[model samples]
Target: MLRDKAVTGMQLTLIIAALLILSSIGYAMGRRRAVAAGRGGALRLHSRPSYHGAYVALWCALPSLLLLVLWSIAEPRLAEWLLIARLPDSIRALDPDRLGLLVLDVKNLAVGNIVSREIDPALQAAAEGYNRFLTLSTAAMVVVAISIGVVGAARAIRGVSPAFRARNQVEKVARNIMLAASIIAVLTTVGIVLSLLFEALRFFDQVPFFDFLFGTRWSPQTALRADQVGASGEFGAVPLFAGTLLITVIAMCVATPVGLFSAIYMSEYAGPRFRATAKPMLEILAGVPTVVYGFFAALTVAPFVRGVGESIGLSVASESALAAGGVMGIMIIPFISSLSDDVMNAVPQSLRDGAYALGATKSETIRQVIFPAALPGIVGGMLLAVSRAIGETMIVVMAAGLAANLTANPLEAVTTVTVQIVTLLVGDQEFDSAKTLAAFALGLVLFTATLALNVVALYVVRKYREKYD
Candidate 1:
């Protein structure tokens, strides 16, 4: 069966290669004819010879590509239908899932893969039937696709003339393709939102929405058997929110001042040579993977924080939020710095000159002129950094232990919404239960929050932009 599938794939690939070759031939023919119709001068043509070539190429490729895509999508389901019909009545009477498993086994068996059950005469016969169907389907696809490509190319080539609007045709097709791509993206986002909403609603049905939103505890494990110990499925999300807020605040505290300062220095003070060197070095911090930061926090920062706390007679968890947040802040610094620097540099130099004309010192000029002018952009950058910190998972997962503590203290371990979402969905688990569905709920909430944050940021940016502009 595997050999048959491989052969079918090779045949399809060859069809695609042949279509491309035909398109290329059509392009050469169309260009030559357009030049001939224009009396060997492209200036006399209605459109450029290149446009004529592209028009012919698109004609040759699009129909065949569309056919190949449709065939690939429908081929498997059609194969399955044929196989099911070949199954014995007794086998067909099996439960839906069991029958599906049998189909899967037959496919795997035909491909020379090990099956769960022993190979029987019926299974062997079904596998053979499946191979035959696949071979016939692939052969049909090759014939139809090649024919479409050839016809499209021939029609396009024959239609080429000095008066032909090849540019308009090609541009219209390109515009339609782009519009289709955009619509697909919009529909995909809607699908995601609807999926999350339905799954979150299912979770809310099992667990009270108010409790999930406002309750302080967040134990999501519902005991399957009543006698199971330590399975109090209290799905309070307040603690998770609080932890996320605490860590975010801590990260901002570390990132904001440092990033802003670096931006100011680089934009207003540094020379061209120094700015070129320093900017890339600072931006390199952003390129360092979060996992590497996680390791640094876990192996180095966590221990150092613990030692400091101990010296001061204060207790610190092995996986403290302080360590995680601080490291996360370092990771986000480049985002704020790079953006803030660009914004500051964008401020008109005339403003600074006018400030200096008023006998303002360099510091005074920056404070009164440059700072105000760049404030909106700086705030936007900081908001982006905050969003980054909130969405960060690896650093928190590795350094801040998964203890959803509802406290402001950075010395204790705490978990964020992302961490909890990952935990709930990891490994094999029942999806119908509130536990699995909670991941969707968390994702929905996070999505809503990020959206709200973006909206607010945009408002602030616009307001400040008007004032500055």
Candidate 2:
């Protein structure tokens, strides 16, 4: 059976390779036919030979590929249905659930896997039949796909002529493909939003919407059994919201001034040699994995922060929000600095020259003219950095303890919404339970917050964007 499976796979691969070879042949033939059609003196074709060749090649490959995909999708279900229909009457009389298990056992036996039931003649015969059907289906697929490819190529080659408008047809096909891709992207996003909405609505049915939104406590631990303790869970999300806001604020405070100043220095003050060397090194921070940043926060920064707080007579937890936010800020620095530097560099050189012509120094020109010109992009970068900080999970999980405390103090342990979402959804979870559904509800809220932030950023960009001649 395993050898047969390997042979089947090899056959599919050969079919694909044959189609590619046929497409190449069609391209050459189509180009030659077009050239022959335009051979007379002062003759000109409507489109280039290349377009005609491409048109033929696409026709040769696309229909066959589409058919192969459809066949692959349908083959498994159709085979299973046929196998069930051919099962013995006694087996078919079993309940649906047990019948499903018998079918699974048959498949396992066919694949030489461990099966729940003892082997019998009937099961053995059914497994052999299943394998035979699969082998025949694969053979049929290869034949049909290859035949279609050859016929389509021949038809397309025959259609090639001086006045066929191959370029327009090819471009129309390309445009339709691009439109399909765009629709797919939009539909995927809509599907995600709808899934979240439906699941969150299910969650809201069990928990009051206003309480989930406005209540102060947020312990989402529901009991699995009736006799289990902590059956009633508190669903107030204010503490999670507070922790998210607090950490984001702390991160932005650390990132904004340092990042903006670094951008200014790199763009205006540094010599070309220094800027070129430093810019790539600065951007490398953005590529470092968040988990590494989390490790640094938990092991190095958290202890350092605790020691410093003790020395200064301040109470700091072993896992404080300060450590996580600080590390996250360092991680987000590249996002702001790199983008702001590029935006500042994109400011018109003429504007700088004008400032200098009016007797302004280099620093004054950067401050008064260049900064204003680049303000919109700079703000956009800051917004991106803020989003990155808000969505961060690893740093908070490692350095900041999962204690959802509603406090303004950065020295205390706290947990953010993202951390809770990760916690609630981890491990074996019952999907219908309020505990599991809370993750989707939290996700919906996070999506809404991010969308609102984007809207505000768009407003800021539009309001400050400068137009120059």
Candidate 3:
């Protein structure tokens, strides 16, 4: 085995170095050819020189990498099967779990420092046999892969015929990679959806879906044993949705105007020095941790809200929903301001100039022209803010009462879906119970709601977005 390792070590390293150098040289040569053709002014060429470089790079790198990955997976499995077949009939007859441990020991003995006392003779022999196979197969694979890459690259270079299909071939590879990248995103979203779906199914098996959706009660306790005395678990979730909506409305009220005005001033009113210094400062609002916002809600904002409510002869809970929602609005202000500023800046300066030429004021041009052009981005930013508000957990948990109450009054304490999900999932509970599963259901609802909002925002932005050069 040591002999095999020594024989292959330098060969594999040299092969890898050669592949990199060869691909780089080939791409440079392809570019020179492309530039010569372009300068000759045939004016009927396929693509830019960079496209040719990228084209060769894809062919050179992708196939060999794929082969290496597949071999890495298959070679181990094949080696294990061959070694297992050599094990004595007695060891092979062991239960699967015990046999698995035995196989694990064999693998460790082959590669790791295993003292004789720790290894059985049968396992040590199996390890030796496996190591022999691995070293041999790995060297063969390295040689085969490098040879194929070099040969294919040589063929591509030789075929750099004036009418070479580099452009079409390169575009096709780019399209495939882009398609794969997009599918990865879709697969990620689908995986998230499936996880939520399964958890929701578990919850529904224990608690009726209708009651969870429509019933106003929100407690989630269940008996640890059949003999315990208590009311049956309260599993309704309508109150959570109500609290989420109320807090979101309050946050939107506070954030929309402040964020919009800040954006307008920054984009159209502030001088360059003020804009440069203040823009990043405003964005610092986003940098503040949610935990800091939680304390801000609990310590500062709650007391102030209570005091204001008291002055109006209104009774406010020590942890008012208003405080949490209000601070959340402050947290999201940057979202609206940053996006709206970009959209406003993108609007043609000529439109604003035309308005000024029509004797319109700066305010008039902004209100009539820039704001209209920026409205879609502003709305997209607002939808994102709304999603953030609904998902916020720490601020509401620290400042708002946990009691799940269905009410719209801003001064009243209310619980949100995220807060309830946290409460249910925090303390130790039986994993199989409805109480634990309910968190998953709540999570599914929250995910779906936000996903829907994002889709709608994307649709509106795509359809209504006005482009300017």
Give, for candidate 3, the lowest lDDT window spanning 10 residues: 1-10
| 1 versus 3: better TM-score goes to | 1
lDDT of 1: 0.92
Model 3's lDDT to the true fold? 0.84
Tens digits of per-residue lDDT for model 2, 193-252: 999999999999999999999999988889888898988899898999899999999899
Off by over 4 Å in 3: 1-19, 28-57, 94-119, 228-232, 307-315, 349-370, 423-432, 455-469
Tens-digit per-residue lDDT, 1-469, candidate 1? 5775787788878998999999999899888888888885647799988889999999999999999999999999999999999999999999999999999999998888889999999999999999888878888998899899889988998999888999999999999999999999999999999999999999999888999999999888788888998566988998888888888999999999999999999999999999999999999999999999999999999999999999999999999999999999999999899999999999988888888999999999988789888888898999999999999999999999998888888999999999999999999999898899999999998889988999999998887773544
Query: In model 2, what is the error at residue 16, expressed in angstroms?
Result: 2.3
RMSD, each candidate, Å? 2.1, 2.0, 5.0
TM-score for each predicted model, relative to the true structure:
0.94, 0.95, 0.80
Better of 1 and 3 by lDDT: 1
Summarize candidate 3's per-residue lDDT along 334-383 as a digit string, tens digits.
99888888888888889888899999999999998888888888998899
Worst 10 residues of 1 by lDDT: 460-469
lDDT by candidate, in order shown? 0.92, 0.92, 0.84
After superposing candidate 2, which stretches have Cα over 4 Å from the reference? 1-11, 41-43
Candidate 2 positional error at 303, Å: 1.3
